[model samples]
Target: MAQSYATDLLHLIQGPPGTGKTLMLAHLAQLLAQDGLRVFVTALTHRAIHNALNKIPQVDANLPVCKIGEERLTGDLNVPNFETFDQSHFAEKSGGDVVGATPFALQSQRLANVEFDVVLFDEVSQITLPLAIMGMLAGSKYIFIGDENQLPPVTTFSETEAAQTSIFAYLAGRGQETMLNITYRLNDVLTDWPSRTFYKGELKASDEAASRRLNLSPEATRWDFVLDPDSPAVFLDLCHTNTTVRSRIEAEVVSELVLSLLMRDVAPQEIGVVVPYRAQSRLIRSLLRRILMDDEVNKKLVVDTVERMQGQEREVILVSFATASQKFAAQMADFLFQPQRLNVAVTRPRSKLILVGSHHMLKADEIVPEHKETMDMLRDLDRQLPDHHPAQRGYQRVKATRKQIANYYRLLISIMLK
Candidate 1:
């Protein structure tokens, strides 16, 4: 629409959260689809891009962009992470053509001679350096679309220090991005909450990278931040064992909870649950089935991974943080510091956020780092949840034996045994 015509080589779109970034990407992808381009579009998580693409009639009717990732979705071939993408198979299938993939996943499949007229990366901020560069290198017409204001690159301990050394550098070498100014969501005052208090918004307020971002007005005075006052919080306390629970097992939990809370005011469809990882994809599928039983429930509750739901709004979201700390839970577990992940969890729920934790641990940012500060703050914060939360909880001490009994008998029996 800008008549800016994205170069087949590389185009980067940077904007605020509510901007139609994903929509624009899908529109371009639809054009590519109509042209009979073997366009393969993918997101960092199955939940993020797949649904948006699947919703488009072009995708649903014609060239459905297959989701090729760790969790195999529709039209996707069974591929693991970047660790095992077969370059030969990619070349053979793609024929030096178009495919969309997560930056890392594209790298894993180190596709040789694979080319595209238009290659797009939606939500590029979530992409790390190595993966982004790899994908950019493979495609002649590369489009990297993401709001740097929303989330930065999520780097693991494995990645190098310099962000520029990675894919972003390659794009910058190409020179200048065409910015999208309008926001699709946040019509009037609702814009302010996300604009000012949102991730980059807060950063901007502090005068750090403030000039780069567009500021929005605040809504506290104009609109009630809480939409529904009478709406009681729907708390679905998920056990940590939720990840490992068989899909059928998880489905049963959803079913029981729905019936148990049926008399309550909230509709089954309104209830949303967000699991920890892609590993819980099966569990979500099962739970979704249970929630949809009422046919009247139009808007599906069972959802995709956390990354997809980032900055998204839902009626009520049950969150399983997916144990941040593997060992014993501590301050870092609270996830207060890591605003990206926290933002994903917090914003999903419209009225309430039902958080189920293995341990009520605090995120590092939740606690004071310095000795004197820790000594002073721990007096207040440490008192909230206990030190020996494991032992005090009683489940940790007996979980092994309890699980064994559950396997022998139905877990319902194991609950009675407990």
Candidate 2:
């Protein structure tokens, strides 16, 4: 289908989590460039642009890709930086078979006279309609690749309104998309709920991904319950004392958990700690720095907010919800319980995902009014069946609202940890 529609003016590919979207885009760009088309690649962020461009060489070692960005911002990508070349020098010396930049950067004088035959937009879900238009103008043909189920572009306005809808979502609503069905990152256990809830059960793990497990030896750790490789998803109900933006107890547990993973021979880079608030990220990072002591080891461990964790994956992802206060959770429900944020957080782990938070607080009754419908649906699903085991109740809720509950992450966690 992709080949048949390769020349379409607007092409959309809905790539769910861990589905090798970047690699697919890279290969497509390579094929287009090989066919003598001038291909331009872009995204909302420099990291995303570099991620897509870095893979082009994997397909062909000698592919000449020009990266347009400040030298410092374009991390170790093997491509030549456009900044180092004068306008005439670039046009003359480099044929510009493939060029990469952010939509904002494409407006630079360096690219004023440049045009592309094809424009590949990576992470298009994070590109607003206006930005998407800017990118579309860069070329005659376009390929948009991203997951609408993940984070949209960050905006100060209310995201619920149609004004802020991303181009990917806008086009996807019109049925102009081809869904990528298989994920290469998550295991079957890790993939289950996200597949059912977000993709209408169409998303699935590839054979290798379905059978993959963490490399850690379960017998090597005393906290095997938390470290069990066989259990891909573990929710640690750390019902700690009240807190607002940051929880010291949660930070302590995260530090200890990192220590255990390190003892089990997990590389520092293989682990990531994601938090909702900057304060919590700082607290966890400080604790990790203190425990690891070595600056080199501490630098490798990524402790960041969900916004920064997009387009990244790790062997083990530890998410700290950091607030145990129901009042605070309710007050921040619009941000905390947003389905896109939760989906990005949980899907970052390739082997295991450990979520630590106060399940009771997350299940607070005083939710944002927008999410009230999701909770009501969960209740309706609960009443449709006779009393049963806790797991069965959770399964029923998941089945009932698989497609409608956009904000069901909070209630889903509550049901799972019950």
User: What are the per-model C-alpha RMSD values against the true structure?
Assistant: 12.5, 8.0
Instruction: Single out the weakest 10-residue window by summed lDDT for candidate 1.
Output: 391-400
**Residues 83-195, candidate 2, lDDT per residue (tens digit)?**
63253254564444788887776677757757788999998878999999988888898888999888888888664753347888788865567888999999876787688
Q: Which candidate is the best by lDDT?
A: 2
**Residue runs of model 2 more than 4 Å from their true location after superposition:** 84-90, 93-96, 162-164, 367-369, 373-418
- Which candidate's TM-score is highest? 2
How close is every model to the real structure, measured as TM-score? 0.51, 0.86
- Compared with the true structure, model 1 gives a TM-score of 0.51
Cα deviation at 337, candidate 2, in Å, is 1.0
- In model 2, the worst 10-residue window by lDDT is 392-401
